[model samples]
Target: MMLKRVAVIGAGAAGLCAAKHVLSRLNRFAPPVRVGTYANGRPIHSSMYRDLRTNLPKEVMMFPDFPFDSRLNSFLPHHEVQRYLESYCQSHAIRPHIRFNTAVDSVRPVEGEEKTTTWQMTSSDSSGRQKTETFDAVFAKCHSSLSLSPSLSLSLSIGEVLHSHSYRYAEPYAGQTVVVLGAKASGLDISIELVKVGAKVTLSHRLPRITYPLPAGIQQSSPVVAVEDDGRLRFQDGSVSAADLGLEIQDHVMTPLYHFLTPPAFPSLFFIGICKMVCPFPNFNVQVQFCLAVLDGSVALPSRGQMEEEVRRELQEKLARGVEHRHLHMMQLEQWDYCDALARLGGFTPLPPVIRSLYEEVWRQRGVHPQKYRDLNYQLVSDARWEALN
Candidate 1:
């Protein structure tokens, strides 16, 4: 039998890390169905929007093993982040393996002799060329979210409800009143954009009233209660609104991943960078390493039933504490512990303490100085501490 290797088709930071380790150890590991990349070639469904800047600082968000360029500011615009990604790809020699301009059609499992499973992957390229290949295992690199951004099948009946993920620009929403959900990161940014385009926006969330000054066209409302017909919205504080459009936004990519990564039914299939309210790149870096550890059998996973039970218990605990069902993925505070546990279980170096210090600091500063928090810079003084710069 010939040994097969994993071909990381996506060039995201997480994918690159997976490739990096896989390339280093050819003999160790490789298996799958529905394992994919950022396929479908639907650039329009991308979550990026014009005029968007990263909510996370570069110091905390950079891949744990790969650092961002030192010259860039702590806070970065979307273009700068893209440039950093390009630089990382070049530095790590990751672009060559990625089949750009191609879309994955389907990945189905084929049962071989002895009950062994292999994945049959089908994909199409830019010229509409199609090909099929087999692999022992798979990695799902697809851009997934509970929101409509990546799930092409999901549709909201309310014609007025819009997904902020598909909003590339604000001009199209001009003169319309939009009610935005989840005032953490994307929601506020989109609200700002809508206000600039002469659209009235009601920024709704469960957090305490934001103290920062906002445009007259934008009003910060209490937590949302219900989505009524005719674009009417109710708030937990008992205020009602009739907005022209409805939308939702949050801090990170929304994906339905099991606790500590990997699906319950298919442990052979790996998923990286699915957790929300996390420091994206750092989370990806840790997750990819942990997945590799599991693949190599260094860290054993619980039985499928046990894994599902843990997920259920985690969700029920959150619900008991009154966590809104929609916000279950928001693991902002739990991220530190989650990453630490993965590192311990995988026998890998944990993220530098400075990362957490700076992340929490930025979170605090963001609420108090939403307008000017990005203006402040910070330098990592050591593995344990970060100091602010003027």
Candidate 2:
């Protein structure tokens, strides 16, 4: 059978998972589809930051069939995650299908019609030769929410501003004062990591409370009340010492770079993840489910009614019934809404579902049940103000 050709750009977690899911469906039903992956560098998983570790536990971060080894310990470091990605490619036997060193420069539809897409992919081989290729369907698996710290305006700055991305080993800033900004996982992690290396660290949280790791091994703080000059970080109803300035924290997610790739076409692209943005897990889960549905023709697009209907059915049956399955639901929904808005604005109707059973499976796995907080003054989880319910 001649398969429908699908090309996935970016060889990261989202891209890899999309390919794996597509391949599984194709193999099972013999769908007329072919899958290919394109990446700028070799198909290795290296994070932009050096001190990076998967925020989620290894169990949650890894694929279902390919779990990380138990002997490797809990939190997987950046280098180890990269190695695991290589292993995932090898185990899935998709290495041959990936064209590494092929960086995508631009992505636009083919000519006038919107059904087809052509990516202006540029890549340099190991021999340092550049080449380009155009593919049918493109999935941008590239990392979206970049962590580069914004340049603090000179007027507002009391000290040096740095992003969690530039942070590596703490040795460079030893014996200096630092104020960490943002209050997300990266900022919190940096604050602790720096403190160990002898730099006096003060976390400058913009929010009312800093999200700390549960069970309180470390990195957990009381509450940040205010920021004091003379380089002191004060907690709500408590106080800490001041220090000499090495680094000052700034909110990167608040910048335009945080919304970099939110284009108004094939809207599924936006829900994957925002660099430092946090969303309720179930919302994200809905978005992922929607992506699978949209790509596989299990859920139709353009009709906001259809997407919302299917989502409602699934949430009531699968997601809301159990706590374990609920985390990814919101995540999935976020992606769906983002993509749907973009598609409507771009005048493209989403592909309707051809496989009825996949829709059933989405409902079954996610289960049918109403949201636990459905009565909290919100119309539906699909509403734009759904985040307020959280």
Candidate 3:
């Protein structure tokens, strides 16, 4: 069958990477796959606000063949990464396929039992004219977090309880006592970044422990307890500072649960860039591991329970050996990152059963089975693999 035109939703790392993979192998296609790119915003790689440098190094974050400019060091700033994405697209000749400022309105299967799907897209042009377009099959490149509509409001002041989405430059929050709510990588990174810039930062979450990066450059360390959460954050039973972070984790935990419990409410988009995997062997290898999973089909769109089970199996084997297990953390983080990147970029959530099953079928057919299908013998967030999962 002739491959229909594929529409890639987001222009972020994974979306671009997926596009790159397709473009790289375009010549192999018999019908010549036509690719089109669409995104809500003009090209904000993950909506990276100010003070956001790649958590992973340039070497790891960069595409395999195309390296970052030699002059720039490892940690490329957010803008630099955006610039790199632009360059990557240019160097790979992906610009012609991209459409900026376009948004996908709705996507549903075409009526009647047909293999083809229809994407009814509504977008506006520079002239303020609205237009609708259709595509055969679309890659919902948006992130998964978008599924949990920002509608859920908490008792915490609306101004105070902001999902990582509302966050941008720290300038507005310079002197005010700020409480960053999240236990995930983005929460941790944003909190640290805020603290670095002289903001009294408190990361509020339920996770009893956190894997902290030490001063000696040791990637791993014993779990640290966060004390002083009323707006201030004290670590490892250290002295308390002013303004403690709120320790309310119920909402945080409930967010993911809500997503799972209410499928219709919570879009099952992939979440990526959760954390950087630190193997003493190489370094921050999150992006590298992500690319591998994508290419291997171990991780892909439309997450399925079986596919997730397969992923868990691989985690068991990799995590079995403390050092080797670092790869598992890397892969897991990439999975989360992909979810987020896809939703933000694609403007659609995979929604369980459909998208997840799609990923399962694709991964299974691609020989991306779990390394080991048995139950995990040990816990994932343990001491041994801490460094590997930095």
Name the best candidate (by lDDT). 1
TM-score of each: 0.85, 0.57, 0.53
Per-residue lDDT tens digits for candidate 2, residues 206-320, read 4555332321222334444555654455665586645344343443221111122323343334334432232212222223344545555654444445445554464456446
Question: Tens-digit lDDT track for model 3 on 140-222?
Answer: 43332231323323333323544565467666655556555445546655665555556665554445544433122112112
Which wins on TM-score, candidate 1 or candidate 2? 1
Residue 309 lDDT (model 2): 58
How high a TM-score does candidate 2 get? 0.57
Candidates, ranked, lDDT: 1, 2, 3
118, model 2: CA deviation in Å? 4.7
In the range 18-45, model 1's lDDT, one tens digit per residue, is 7766655557743211222444445542
Give the CA lDDT, 0 to 100, for residue 326 in model 2. Answer: 14
Model 1 scores worst on lDDT over the 10 consecutive residues at 149-158
Ranking by TM-score: 1, 2, 3
* Best candidate, TM-score: 1
On lDDT, the stronger of 1 and 2 is 1
Model 2 Cα shift for residue 230 (angstroms): 12
